[model samples]
Target: MDVVLVSRTQAKLDATADEIRAQYPSRRVKCVRADFTDPDTSAVYSHVGRELHGLEVGVLVNNVGLSYPHPEYFLKAAEDRCGDADGGKAAASAGWGPQLFDDMVRCNITSMVNMCRLVMPGMADRKRGCVINIGSTASRIPCPLLTMYGATKKFVEKFSRELNTEYGGKGKHGTNITVQCVMPGYVATKMSKIARTSWLVPSPDTFVKSALQTTGLEPVTTGYFPHTLMVKAIELAESISESMMARTVMNNMLGIRARALRRLAKEQQQREEAQSATATDK
Candidate 1:
């Protein structure tokens, strides 16, 4: 199948395209550089739509997403304000105020909605297509420090389910379009900051292979067996004591947050020392 790859980095896209071409010499691979984090959602998707105008896109994978640099409380995450000229008053009034939060909404939520809008109509006209939305296990339960990220993923889950029902069969449009949401657990990727692959945390290649197999079979799945087990464990914990489970999750996220902050501080100190050494040499 001909593939269209879109992401923020052109170099990475080119590299991925090369890999695909090496694997399947006959298949055509097109790369489009687009940043989903851009606040101007219309322009971003419009460009994407133009690039894909003639292509019969059989499958659209809404894989682009953004998460917290480190797990943090909703309000606390917005502490930096990210150059809010209003002295953060506007963000404060909105309850949670972070440029990062707005970015996450655009990247995680808006990208999916807009891409579907662009691709689904053609799929309906042809009467066939598949949409794969990557969600997260965090959406299944209450995530305290990772609240906004989880909420955005929850939106993905609900949207995929409802959209699937609308077009997966003979519906209003009389089309068969499958919208599947794959809610995966930890994977060894740059986004997850997971360097090593474990049984519980598969590599991107491994996770994608497994998830691809479940395309039309399952509407909502963890994709990997280990991830499914992880979700089941979370379900068990919720059933036993939701409050306890929440506290456990909060404590885990707090530990992660503390370590991330410590790492950031250390890196900053190292940078300062390097600058000082350079100044001394001068």
Candidate 2:
């Protein structure tokens, strides 16, 4: 059983590769830098497969994501950030917050979509392959502040489910691809070090390990253990009230916003300290 990890960051690719090598010694695994942001970048997947000599990618993990780094607004966080009640279509027309959203869609939504397409043909031809779609619990829990990031993720969830159910009954091209969506909580990556969200932050190792645990299955495991319980608790507490769900989601969003802001603050302090040390050295 060979594994394929599609990601953009070189450092993450390296770390993930090392873990795969050390942990899954019996199964040959390969890690390749896949920058799905570009339409032409998917060739890297095929190139890597060819380089692996005798390995064929039976398992594909789509773990690429972004928050506010994109250039357009797929999902608007601030009503005032966009336009009219019709979801700021006018604002987007006027170039208010569309750029970031579009960029996010490309990264969060489109890129992963391409990965699925790239692997489907081969998997379908063989009638045996698995696809893991990694999403954020943030989608299930409304993150008002994350704005476009949340919306793109929502799309990711829906797209994954639909794809799974669609080709689930019958294998396409003789290869039935099962798409599983994994929504994790806050993970401590370089970005996490800059922004600490109390929303069940886990180390990348833990998060990915859990994620790998249920790759072929659609298991929406929260990033933190306690937070996972909170999801059930929140659902039960608001189980009677449909409105409560929205309320709870928003409340969670507020917490996330605060945590994100605090992370930024901590990052700022670190930057200032580094600068001070440099100045002293001079």
Candidate 3:
């Protein structure tokens, strides 16, 4: 199976590619620097798989994201963080504090939609493909400080389910593209190094490995550990809220989240300084 992983950081791309190669030595695994945050995000990267490689994309994992340490300044930081991907004029209309919510909607939201749009034509042509969109647990419930971050992921979670129901019909285009949202509770990545102590955190690879397995089942796959089971057995459970809320108990969960944030930020600073020194040939 030929696979491509679109990652923002080259280091992460290399790590994931290495693992895939070790597991499936016979299969081709390609890693591309397709940062979703880039204003010039395009679908051609995905098209390259179908057109150039002579391989059908059996799976697509949309796992790109960002967040602010403090919720108090989330709106303020987002406007500057994200430039105008929607439009120069519409940016002001958004009425967000800085960068129209401090970041580019094009990268965060529009680009994902465009990628899916591009891949669907080919997947529908072949009647096989799976799209796994990595979202956040904040989408299902809510996190006070993670307002916009949560909202953006919520849109993605909702989109994947609808796409599964609407596009998976065999009659329309004879397509069997499985669309599933792979939202995780918390994981130890560079971004969330501050969120070090998640009750049921999985490594990046572990999270992807499981989510990839459930591509064809349904839209929503409850995030975290037992939560994933709760999603599958929602109807059998006594209450919808009771089954899912155990792992992500809120304030208690984020008890140490603030301190972790400080540590991660310090680590980021040291890395930046080291990179600068190296650039000067130190």
Candidate 4:
């Protein structure tokens, strides 16, 4: 199997490629370094094409996405911290500024669309391929603070569903292309701030292992068993009333948002004090 990795950092890409090579010595691994936030996507696509020049790519995973470092009211985030330099970093630094919004859309939505466009035609012609789109539980559930992010994921779910129906039907184009949308609740990842894995929150590898099993069986899946149960519970709760279900989710999210805001505030204060002390010393 040939694995092609694409990301922003060359060093991280090299390390990941090395790990892949070490794990599967027989499999060919290629890495293409490109930042999805760039306005010019043509260059990124061109680089990816160049890297995939020789291989008959069988699987395409549209896994890249971005979210706000912490939850905030839409208006509040837009009005404040728009010009902060720490807009795109991890949780402690990320802010939902206008530029950050653009970057998020480009990274999360536009990249996936362009990648699909670049790869789908070839797959359709060959009549054998798999496209795995990584969506979020936020799309399926009611998430107040993560409004735009959830909206973007909703687009992904819709897009993947339509794409599968159009190209995956054996009767339509006689194609065998599989487009699977995997919406996960949470896994131990930097993005989710999940430092430790548990029964409910499995590791990425564990989630992927379960997700792969449901690939042609379901068009959309929660991926992990715990995530699936969580989605089902939410759906069951929704049977009472949409507003009640939303309120329940929103209330829980409010607590998370409050804690996140506190962490960011404390970190910012520490930075200010450190800078002040340095200036006094100088």
Candidate 5:
């Protein structure tokens, strides 16, 4: 079957399209460049719809998402720095602000809903289609530091299930639309910043293959076996004591946050030192 790939960067899209063509020479591949981070939702979806016009989109993957650069508390994340005219003080105090939250909602939640609306009607008319919404393990547990990101993914899980029920083989025409929410743990990808792969953390291609196998079979899944095990363990922990599980997760995320901040500080210091040396030499 032919494919239509939509993403923010044209160059990446072209490179991916080339790879697909190499694998399947006979199949057609089209690229549509649209950034989901755009606050103007209507215009973005409209452009995507125009680009996809006249094509029978049998499968829709709502995979575009955004997350915090590092885990942080909601209060700090939502701090409005607009009041600080110079912005330097607030920037020194906190690395994130209200705009980051807005972008997360727009990119993670709005994109999925809009894409489903734009593509599903065509599926209804045709009487068959599949949708894969990529969620995260963060949604399955109480993610303390990564609160907003987890909440957005939880939205994905709920929306996909409800939408599946609404359109799955119920109407007079029997529209067999399958909406599957795949809540996966870490995979070796740039987003997760993991270059090496293990049994627990598979490559993106491996994860996709496993996820696709469960399209019609499972409405919601972890997609990979190891990921399922991880969620199951988290569930067991919650069953024992919900508070304990929350605390455990929060502690782990706090450690990650600390390391990220330390790295950022080190980089900044190195830059300043280099600049100082350059000025002295001049």
Candidate 6:
């Protein structure tokens, strides 16, 4: 079995490759460093074709994603980080300007679609392949502060479901291509900012292991058992009253946003003090 690890960080990729090599000495582990945020990511497809040559990719994991530095309202995030969405005003004049949103679109949506485009045809021809897309439980509900992220993940959920229906089967004309959308609630990963693994939040390896168990069983899942439970609870709550659920989630997000802003303010103050102290010493 040949495994290809693609990421923006070379050191991390190398470390992962080493770990995989250690686990399966006979299996080949390859690492490709590519920034999917860039338009140049299209080039990586060409590289894959050249490097893998006649070999078929039996599994493809579309796991690359990007979220906000911290949760905030869509308008606030758009204006503060991606320039003026309202108008070319001073309040939003000095920021990332549409570029951040563009990058997110590329990373979350375009990259996944492009990867499926690159590998799905071959899988169809071979009549065997598995595509696992990492979605989020955020997609299942209406999250105000995490609007854009949730929307993109919803896209993944819908896309994966349709793709599986379109290609997954063992019939005479079946493509035999399996597409699974794994929606995780929370995992103890850098992205989740959860340092400790708890009943609710599992480690990435544990999450993946659990998710893999349901690959051919379900086209869409919460992946981890605990996460599935969490999702079910949320679904139950939503079933009772979606408005109440939305209001409850909105209140929770508002609190998180408040705390994040406070933390940022504190950090900025600390930085300013450090600068002042340095100037005084100078």
lDDT measured at residue 113 in model 5 versus the true structure, 0 to 100:
94
For all candidates, what are the clash counts?
A: 0, 14, 14, 0, 0, 0
Instruction: Please write out the lDDT profile of model 5 over residues 188-253, one tens digit for every residue.
Output: 988887899999999999999998888898999999999999889989989999999988888999
* Predicted candidate 6 versus true structure: per-residue lDDT over 1-282, tens digit per residue: 789888889999999999999999999887878788886765866765565556689999999998876666676776543322322232232323456677778889888998898788889988899999999998996678878889899999999999999999998767999999999998998988889998898888888888889999999999888777778898899999999999999999888766655665666567779989999999
Worst 10 residues of 5 by lDDT: 82-91
Write the residue-wise lDDT of candidate 4 on 235-268 in tens digits.
8889879899988878898888767766766777
- What is the TM-score (0 to 1) of candidate 4? 0.91
**What do the candidate models score in CA lDDT, each in turn?**
0.86, 0.63, 0.62, 0.84, 0.86, 0.81
Which stretch of 10 consecutive residues in model 6 shows the poorest summed lDDT? Answer: 86-95
Q: How should the candidates be ordered by TM-score, best one leading?
A: 5, 1, 4, 6, 3, 2
Model 4 lDDT at residue 151: 90
List runs of model 3 lying over 4 Å from the truth. Answer: 42-54, 78-104, 172-174, 194-199, 228-282
Worst 10 residues of 2 by lDDT: 86-95
In candidate 4, which residue pairs get closer than 3 Å at backbone N, Cα or C atoms, i.e. clash? Answer: none
Question: What does candidate 3 score in Cα RMSD to the true structure?
Answer: 8.2
Assess the local accuracy of residue 175 in candidate 2 as a C-alpha lDDT between 0 and 100: 36
Put down candidate 3 lDDT per residue, 1-282, tens digits, no spaces. 677776668998899899889999997877766666555444544543344355466677666666654333354345543223422322222234554443535555665787787667778778888887877666766465566777888888889888888767567554777888877766667767634544467676666666656656657775456556544453344256754554354554455444444554566567778989999995
What TM-score quantifies how close candidate 5 is to the native fold?
0.92
| Runs with alpha carbons beyond 4 Å of true place in candidate 4 | 80-92, 279-282
| Native-referenced Cα lDDT, model 1 | 0.86
